[model samples]
Target: MKLKFTLLTLFLVLISALSFAQKSNNSQSIISGKVNISKYHSREELKNLDKGELLTLYIERIEVIVNILPNIAFATKPGVTMASLGIPETKDNKKALEENKEASDTYFDSTIEFQKSILPYSDKKDLIAAILFYESTLKALHTYEDFKKD
Candidate 1:
């Protein structure tokens, strides 16, 4: 029947479109970086702060990154509500975080270099805006993706 043929054609088109999408999505790599959170507070300060203060600090910093996602918001906020739990950082973690953040910076620099390469294009403003927007979006995505781990 014509209806059956039409349905099959539509399904094939959808399958091909999905395959194309996967390829495009996989082409661009993720940016790497980890930020050390200890700089925001000293060991003395973290030790001294009560649960309420630590919770406030966590909320203040993390809120912007995860944005409106309820599931992710839930994972971060509730359990750690108890504070004065002692500092989580060690010398090793600090060194690791520093290295991760450095990698992030390097990735950012590469993106900038890419923009410079395309700067000679006629649409200067649009090109710059697009690249800048991409950078900010990537930064946010990177933070959001690494929320629980870092």
Candidate 2:
């Protein structure tokens, strides 16, 4: 009876150990699958590009914003200069501020248009970067609008 009990206990321990090992293996596979899905391009792929080619690609996409919305470059100049000079925000600055706000709206509109035009041809990483940049620009524009209201 004593030998049978000991064998039974050993058998249970082996089964539990196998179960734990299988669980860990399953968890590791799940985590590795997630990592693979999150990364669209590996380091090796990005490294395959020739020097300046990557930069040229980014500039090419960005040029759509620059070219399509020339007003964005000049319309905000006065407000930017005033803010940089530490000039107090007063009623007199409202016109310039409003112009800046309009320019920002135009810029956001142009960015949406540019994304529609360029996204189909862009790499996954570039698309991700462009989206982040667009979000940042949108946030900045909102902030500017809030500042103008004050």
TM-score of each: 0.29, 0.29
Top lDDT model:
2
Model 2: residues >4 Å from true position, as ranges? 1-89, 129-150
Best by TM-score: 2
Give one digit per residue, the lDDT tens place, for model 1 in 42-72.
4455556554454444433333322222223
Q: Which ten residues in a row have the lowest lDDT in candidate 1?
A: 27-36
How does residue 95 of candidate 1 score in lDDT?
61
TM-score of 2: 0.29
Model 1 misplacement above 4 A: 1-87, 122-150
Candidate lDDT scores, in order, read: 0.44, 0.47
The Cα error of candidate 1 at residue 78, in Å, is 22
Shift of residue 130 alpha carbon in model 1, Å:
2.6
